[model samples]
Target: MERAAEAAREGNAQYFLNLGDDELIKLCQKRDEDGRSLLHSAVVGGNMHLVQLLVERCGNERINSQDSEGWTPLTSAVSCGFEEIVKYLLSLGADPNSTNAQNRTPLHYAASKGRVPIIKLLIEAGAKTNTKDIAGWLPLHRAASAGRAEALRELLLHTSKPLINARDISGSTPLLLAASGGHQAAAVLLAAKGADVEAEDKDGQTPLGAAAPHGQLRDALVALATGEKTLDDFEN
Candidate 1:
């Protein structure tokens, strides 16, 4: 099994390709202590050939199979920025909305990590933008918290105004999350897209109030909040 794992890692396609289907299935079904299948290893290792070979042999169920952490091969690909691998997996019927132990989807990881390309692939694959994780945080919240502007822009386009302003369990809206995290660009973008800058969280903290810490270009954000200026106007 270790040798097979190494073969997958090293892109030794012929080694596995030569094995009979029965032998291959037996080899692929073996999991590590964490319950991660050979498919998981292929994805994580970024070996597209091995991934294709394994998925073709192992079939759809195995391709979408989750490990103990509930992460599918698609999840691993998204996390690792393996765009081509992610595309191939989705094309082969891998679930785009697969969640992990935290109930976070591949979209959540793509948004949080600023994977603009991956974000496109996931959303086009029909990944839901509003799906909340254990913390009641959506992909928007994750993108804002991470200060991912381009990814945030893509999300803003597809999300409705209300969901753009939607609050998480801790009462942090995307704007508040962006501001508090010192993401000036993201906060402005959220505000321009109809997020209420004055909307308070459960703790009565608004985006402006939360942004008090970073103190970056305060006037610009304040002007944006009050409708005196829009982020788009600034660029124009």
Candidate 2:
């Protein structure tokens, strides 16, 4: 099974072709010690061709198959920023909202990596914008916490009703997370999109208040919150 997985990772299509169709089916169904299928290995390898080949032989049922960490091929692809592989997997009936053991979806991974295209793609593929992970964080929260302004923008735009001020397990909104992380541009974007600057976390730390001691752009965040500055002002 490890050899087959390695072959898939190496994009050695001939390896599978050499095996009879029945043998290939068994190989595809086999799992490694970690419970990862050939599809998972193919995705981790960033080989879209191998992924397609495996899916074609194993059927789409394996597209959403989860490994030990509960990461599916789609999540793995999104995490690695393989936009083409992600799209192909989704088209092959991969569930965009499929959760791992931590309840983290592909959207969460994409947002964290700042993969704007993958974020947009997953959202369009029916990924729930408000889906929370084990940490009670939505994809928006992940984007903000990662300081991914472009990814946050794409998420907000695609979401029908974005929970701009939604709280995570830490009681922190996207704005609060962005501010605490010193993501000035992300904070500005959240503010422009109706995020509440005065919203507090479990520690009663408002966005600007949370940013004051740690972030270099605390003043700019305050100005943006108070309408003293616009997002365009930061572009200059």
Candidate 3:
């Protein structure tokens, strides 16, 4: 196990790869002060070949395995913008819905980064649109809050109705997050899906109040304020 770690540090790729799966498995199990797998190091090093070798040999049962930080291989790929690796992990049946320590799924990461292709692929491959993270913010809220217009639009196609006004831990709805982030297009979509323009957060801030500071978002806020949609329409 120590040898593998040394090999990794010394950049001895062949020595590390030549180690048997049983030996590698033991090393993979070994954790740093903060837990991270050989897979984590492999991915972090951008060694796609090594990642594939590890996946094929060690097995794909825990393809989405997390380190001490609760980040999966898929999450890491999304964070690093490794689109090819992301697709390969999904093909290996990685659980898209699995959250890390932060309770954020791959969809949230993809949406937050505006990785439109990754977002589309994840949704098509069965990622849930409305799953909440640690913050209780849905994928929609993350996308809208990050101003990921295309990702939000792509996500909408999968669900006819995805709790548009679902509140997070802070009692801020998707509309509120989008408005606060000055995401005009996202605010409009949330409104069309029946988000309450008048909904308030713990601080008594409505979506309009959140968006008032942004010139582009103000128009969307005004439109939603005038629309007939109400929170009652979305009540479960």
Candidate 3 Cα errors over 4 Å, as ranges: 1-25, 160-162, 224-236
Model 3, C-alpha of 82: deviation from truth (Å): 1.3
TM-score of 3: 0.81
Task: Candidate 3: give its CA RMSD in angstroms.
Answer: 5.3
lDDT for model 2, please: 0.86
lDDT of 1 by residue, 1-236 (tens): 88887777677889988999999999888887777788888888898888888878877678788889999889989999999999999998888888899999999999999999999988899999988999989999999999998899998877876899888898889988998888878887888888887889999999888888767645667888677987777667
Rank list by lDDT? 1, 2, 3
Tens digits of per-residue lDDT for model 2, 1-236:
87888887887878877888788888888889888998888888887777787778778778878899899888888998999998898888899999999999999999988998888788888988888898989989999999999999899987655489888988999999998888878988888778888888888989978888765577777777678888888877
Candidate number with the higher lDDT (2 or 3): 2
- Candidate 3 lDDT over 1-236, as tens digits, reads 55555555444578766787688777766655556666666666566777787777777766777878798878888777778888888899888888888888888889888888888778878898877888898877888889887777777677557377788888898888888887777777777667787899888999888877987566655655676444243332
Model 2 RMSD in Å is 1.6
Stretches off by above 4 angstroms in model 1 are none
Model 2 pairs whose backbones collide: none
Return whichever of 1 and 3 wins on TM-score.
Answer: 1
